[model samples]
Target chain A: MLIQRLAIIGVGLIGGSLARALKRANAVGEVIGCGRNINNLQQAVELGVIDRYDTNPAQAVTEADMIVVAVPLGTIASVFAAIRDNLSAQAIITDVGSAKATVVADARQHLGNYLPRFVPGHPIAGTEKSGVAASFAELFEQHRVILTPLQETDPQAVATVSTMWTQTGAEVIEMSVTHHDEVLAATSHLPHILAYSLVDTLAKMAERTEIFRFAAGGFRDFTRIASSDPQMWHDICLANQQAILQILDSFKTDLTQLITAIQQNDSQYIATVFSRAKSARDKFCG
Target chain B: MLIQRLAIIGVGLIGGSLARALKRANAVGEVIGCGRNINNLQQAVELGVIDRYDTNPAQAVTEADMIVVAVPLGTIASVFAAIRDNLSAQAIITDVGSAKATVVADARQHLGNYLPRFVPGHPIAGTEKSGVAASFAELFEQHRVILTPLQETDPQAVATVSTMWTQTGAEVIEMSVTHHDEVLAATSHLPHILAYSLVDTLAKMAERTEIFRFAAGGFRDFTRIASSDPQMWHDICLANQQAILQILDSFKTDLTQLITAIQQNDSQYIATVFSRAKSARDKFCG
Candidate 1:
């Protein structure tokens, strides 16, 4: 087994799925799920996603060989602080957070001596759904897991976390924390903000019900991310604010150019932009 | 059979799918596929999406009892002009265009004596894939077909068109052309523009390859519409320019508020906007 005892803080979709995937792969000896929600932790155990459950992070990580912090961005520091004094020296800590810079900063601030063993990570896979009930063993299969290990972090710790993610059927790629935040801001965070904003704008209008009633498959797919958990998104927005704002500004400039082009009936401009975008998306996106 | 001979202009996804659906329901006699591409039309006939093929709209519509003009918005006027003189007196003409105002105007300009028999329609359905190869008999099943009949248009024409759509298992909803365009701008056209712009913006960035490499399922779904036909969206943007620009402006205002909220770390404001959007999307969207 790659892991003798694994402590998974925040037994939600990502954490639970990781545990389940590891168990299915026979790479983990024991998985102990810990969270604020005792019922969810218990459910994770009952579902066999974890070997046991703990309501306290300190108690959960007491004898664990590794800890997976899968909590929302807002709670990263607190979860880190609570588990700091209890972690074993060899215990490699990694996260499944969407944002990396703040998460690594949280480790530095609250992980104490264990900061060297902390590897900030993000699994580039999830549904709009949440909680242990939404967790699946194949969630990370064929998906990418990005690791943004700090310079002070132990190389062995990074390798352990990468191996663990690989056992869960994810392809692990390492990059700097700044690059992770910026790229995710452009690809994930910005589109989410646009979707939420678009849905809210339409819903607040005079003909909202009618507008939504007649919405086609395109609109449904476009706004699907708007159905994601708001509190989680709230934390993400705050954690990744600068990068998101930068990309948002870039998008705004582009959108303004489109507005002017359409107003001026510049079909060639619209076509070129759209054609380039289509070719790029077709080439890059699955 | 409700139609003695059904003529499908621009026998691509929507048109070919409609023909397939009607044939599956046994609602039409002879199906004639017409488009500029002789190869695609020949393939449609070979695939049984249509009984025969014609390269000219005028020749294709001769003696046809029902006609579906499924060409792009930019070519609606030309297609209507081409088929106007060849339409039988009893023939009912309808379009499957996205924007109804320009389509109604196109009919009025070109259909002449056939104006009363013209019905403006949009079967709120599609996939990113196009052509007869992508068409299916169930493309419109359980979907909505919106018809915007003009004042000078015959109710019998609308009824017949509605029944034909019903035969394809679509629920027909009728509204004024103005309301349809405005609502569609918010729900459909504006989202397409944003997706195209977002994808184009990211693809233009210095780290485009790495950014796309780390993009998750959320990004994939959010930008799925970006992979749609560029020429179709180009036509849509120009045809529905005014309404699209208006909703886009509203969306921009809301987006600005979000930017301000994120920059200022106004957590409550961001939470409120995101929460409302989630709730509305959960309620109104499928």
Candidate 2:
């Protein structure tokens, strides 16, 4: 087995999917889930996502060779602190948080001697849905998993985490913690912010009813991310505040230029921006 | 057949799809296509999207009982003028433009005495992909077709256009020309602007490669409309300038508020906006 006694703290969509995927690959011997929701934990056990369930973080990580911290970004520090004193010296630790610079800093502050064994990761896979019930074994198939290992982190620990993700059918990529945070801020976090803001703005308009009634496939696809978990996104915005704000500022500047072009009917300027964006989006995005 | 002779000017995605859907339903006979690209027109005929092809709009509309002007919004005036004198006196004319008020004005200026027979309609359908190659008979299935018929427009002409849309399996609704423009600005036009702006902003950043490389499903779905035809959108922005500018102002206000909330780390404000948007999006959009 690739992992013996794998403990998943805050076992929601990300953690549950990891456990299910590892178990399906026959790469994990024992899976223990810990979460705030008792019913969810019970459901996870019944579905074979975990071999057992625990309520205490200290007890969940007891003798676990590997521990996965899959909580929201705001709670990552506390989660790290809770299991720090309970982990074996040889144990390797990791997290699946979207923001990485803060996670790496939190690990430095709370992981104590286990800092070198901590490998931070963010899997670029998920639906708008949350919780254990929404997870599946093939969630990471053909997906990318980014790992951000700090300078003090052990190479062996990074390799172990990389192998674990590879076993789940994910392509593992490594980058600096700061780069991960900044890049994610531009791509994922900023899009969520824009989607939420646009939807809220439209909902408050006098033509809200008719606007939604006549919306087509394009608008639906454009706002699909607005249905994401608000609490999770709230934490993300605050955790990656600096990088997100920087990218958000850039977007606003470009938006201002676009609005001005539209107002003045500068067809050439507007077309240039739209054409460039179309080329980039078609080349890079799905 | 519901239409004996139908002429489609500027036969592209919208016009080709309409022709294909009507022919599939046996609702039209002797469909003739006209466009700047002779190869595209020939391909339309080969795919059975049209029964014949014509390079001249005036000749294409000769003796035709119904004509669908499916050109870009900026070209709508010229296309109307091209066929105005050649159309049969009893011919019913309609358009598939996204913006309605400008189209109504264009019809008034160029359609001559046929203004009463002009139906200003917008089919709430289409993908980012353009041209007849991407067109399909099922494109309008389960979609909406909004018809903004003026007071001077004949009820018989409106009924004929509505029946044509209905035969394509689309639900047809009628509204004022002004209302259609405003609502479309919020739901469709505004979203496209935001998407194009965001993609352009990221592409201009120094970290463009990394930003796009890490873009996940959410970003892909959020920016899908960024790949839409730039010329069409350029025409739309100018044609629907007033409404788009007004909605764009509202979006900017909300976005500025969101940026401030993120900067201050105001958890409650961010959460409220995201939550409200999630609920509204889940309730209204797919």
Candidate 3:
């Protein structure tokens, strides 16, 4: 009921799931799926994620009133460039990239006149899986959708994008692109980096075989994100390099201090760190 | 059927759960729960985890055919020193400590001749919650139980401990105490350390109030172990300091390399790391 013509570029998990959710909610008129993979487009159509499919990003944009680019962070610039001229004069464009600063900057660079309607957005929801087959309408339900709009971005476009996400059951919040990058670096980017690093270190150890077998539930749960799309995480780390590095430095400083306390048998210091961490986890995580 | 006159020290989660499992399997004739906490002992008896209770560790060990020391790792030495003269001459002693080498060495220092029967064992299963109230009979069902016996450990005593654990539906395996520490440094200790560190960092951030509200499923799953018993993790980190530090150093090196790859825009290196980690996770964790 809210959107008339909706085009989803790179119809993978996020795009396909959004398409399905729009159909389920009856929030959009016509849904179009666009991607480089012809098979994925056909599969999306067969799966009814979209009413139709198109391999041409520009052609797909021309037939839509709104476009949602759901691709890896590194590819957002190219996708925007490809469809910038084709998007309807009044069409609102958004993205589901993990990093917003780089993507916003890329949109500004690629689409000069269209910058006001390029409402950069990120849905804080994902699984350790990818592709159209992994999508579901409820994927965005109860999730956070952060919109990072430049000062030049039109308020009207931002409201439309925010309302669209709200229709899909997401809570929308506005944030500066830089702050979004830093906040997510601590909350999301750093955790994935640690998971991949730990797994890589364990693999290099001589006890890798037995270590893997005995990993059990805790290790499995802790490292679950390491199984995510490698290309996607790689793009995220690169796009948000400075912020992720800052967080990693902070993490190392804290870890080293805790290690030193243990080495010196500083039970009081250890207890304080442990107690504070426990209280925070209980309060925030619960 | 596999044990007799079993004495369980500490009468908390692991201890109470073991007693409950033994009773359910009818593997022991008389089960005794010992702890400084009088209420915990009464509660354990009320919950049918123990046939009887003892406030004094020595009195609890006097008639036991086997003794299972399930106190915190930091208290293992003092517990052994207190019960050294009370343990039955033919009794086989084992512990359910996370760190094996330190506990085994402490037992050796205090129990001397009885050290050969003091086989160190670790049940690789636990919940984030603690205490007698959170325990259950099937806590160790189909779980891995690793026995780290010293070179001078009695083969017969090792067999007895293995049989007891097997009766509780745990698959018992043998490993060197040093190897056990190193492997667990990666599998359990490091994961916990990272979780605690991440939670602490996020809770102290400027946007914590807002971020905590929007923390979706991924953040919740990643930090689930951060809610574990802080005292328990503190003991584990301190007891396994050397191995844990080594693993932390290894993880830091791997993370530094990843950071460098991201900074330099080395997509190939980043992609390779991700692919290898993804494959390793799929093969080992899935």
Candidate 4:
């Protein structure tokens, strides 16, 4: 099962960057891009990210041995519906969506038995920028890519998808789709939501303009994820709302404790939290 | 007058780093260090961060032409009290404390009319690591050093302190002490608190060990500030409780809005927040 021909749906930052990286590695023989925007398709072709471009999802799916759906989470089902009948029997399709359970469920419903070959993955790598112009070869290097393979997934098929991602320089870890959503909701999804909300709240304040001017390097870095594509993040928040809400509740509890410590001038409690956090970050992230 | 002799109180990260940078720039004729910890004083001398170490605050202040208080916020008043009558009348004094208003207030009450020459300053630069070992010459270069000077502050004294910080490659900005705290609460203090709290929350999660194992670059960068000194952060949170609590309340409200949007599947609201945040970050932080 050599992935000689690859079709990338929604050739934006993640998808476009993957195509660019694959092309740079020359891992695949032919790459075709499919997108709703003709200008984007043309620009992707001009950028040499794809060898060809097509507006029709059906036509693109018919020729490729592998397909990557890189659209927002809300559109995952429609995307699958559009390509369901045209996908080759041997085609190994995957996605770069942030949420996993809902995407995997959609695949199971739409593609039926072929869902086994549908590897739902998320590469935990991105920049503040978006679109084909922002794509780069090293986008996924040394990044974690969690693959949520359904119980019905074939071992051989999972291995094939894992190999494809490995070639793109991502370290793939397999996890239950539900677990993936829960973990991401804690680590990635909730963080983005918090950053976005913080930005909005500060922007509405009386000193909004000066607020940004005073945002130190830490604030800038903490809020960097808020710069992600709005539509994409919006789709993720809605799609993974339950998990996100649960994580938010936990975060609020933690924040409330912190606030209480500060208000009560509990220096000891504050020190304990700071020490625990520092040690955890150093041991794991250092 | 030439700074033929200098005294630095509480030789930790800021004081030690300033000593290193001053040495590199060939600005000081002699450096004397004072601290409660005899081992830290010895380490500062061993690391060449000071020319001499003194456990007696009176002896350290009496022999120096200038003094820099680098101790914790709560300890600043005691540092002044220990050296109040022992100081040389010509000796210009400054502090590197994070909160300016409290220190300024302390200096006013403790030193009386001598307070006009006591400049309250903060170097807006640091790393998570601290102590004498973490001191480096280039730490303050290209960074901002804010001075909170009152109406009673002498112009010559301000100029001298400004010149010293400038020589170390920092751009000095003058502002009111209260304004400094307010701006910094949004910029530095709040961010550190949030980062530490976020890390603590994640660390306490059941599967955190595993989640951290897969923590990517973004997570590492986002939580980097959490690894700062626990005692330092504890003192800061207690000293700057009012502003921090106000900002935290605002942050919570914004977070609630985002959670609501996600729950309702309001893609438009989510995208708007993300886009606005992205634009704000790019405009201010780019």
Task: List the candidate 3 regions with Cα displacement exceeding 4 Å.
Answer: none
Model 1 is docked with a DockQ of 0.89
Question: Deviation in angstroms for A252 in model 4?
Answer: 0.3
- Candidate models: Cα lDDT each: 0.91, 0.92, 0.88, 0.84
Docking class of 2: high
TM-score leaderboard ranking: 2, 1, 3, 4
TM-score of chain B of each: 0.99, 0.99, 0.97, 0.96
Over the stretch B36-108, how does candidate 3's per-residue lDDT look in tens digits? Answer: 9898889888888888988889999987989999999989999999999988889999999999888977987
lDDT of 2 by residue, B2-75 (tens): 99999999789999999999999999989999999999999998888999988999999998999999999999
The fraction of reference A/B contacts recovered in model 1 reads 0.93
Task: Provide the DockQ value for model 2.
Answer: 0.89
DockQ of each: 0.89, 0.89, 0.72, 0.67
- Steric clash pairs (candidate 3): A1-A27, B1-B27
The regions of model 1 sitting more than 4 angstroms off are none
lDDT of 3 at A114: 93
| Full candidate order by lDDT, most accurate first | 2, 1, 3, 4
lDDT of 3 by residue, A1-286 (tens): 7889999998999998888888888889999888888888899989999888788889898768789999888889999889987878889999999998889889979987999988999999989999999999999888889999889899999999999888888889888898888888888888888888878888878768889989978888889998999999999989998998898888888887887887898888877777777898789777
DockQ of 4: 0.67
**Backbone clashes in model 4, listed as residue pairs:** none
- Candidate 4 ranges with C-alpha deviation above 4 Å: A24-26
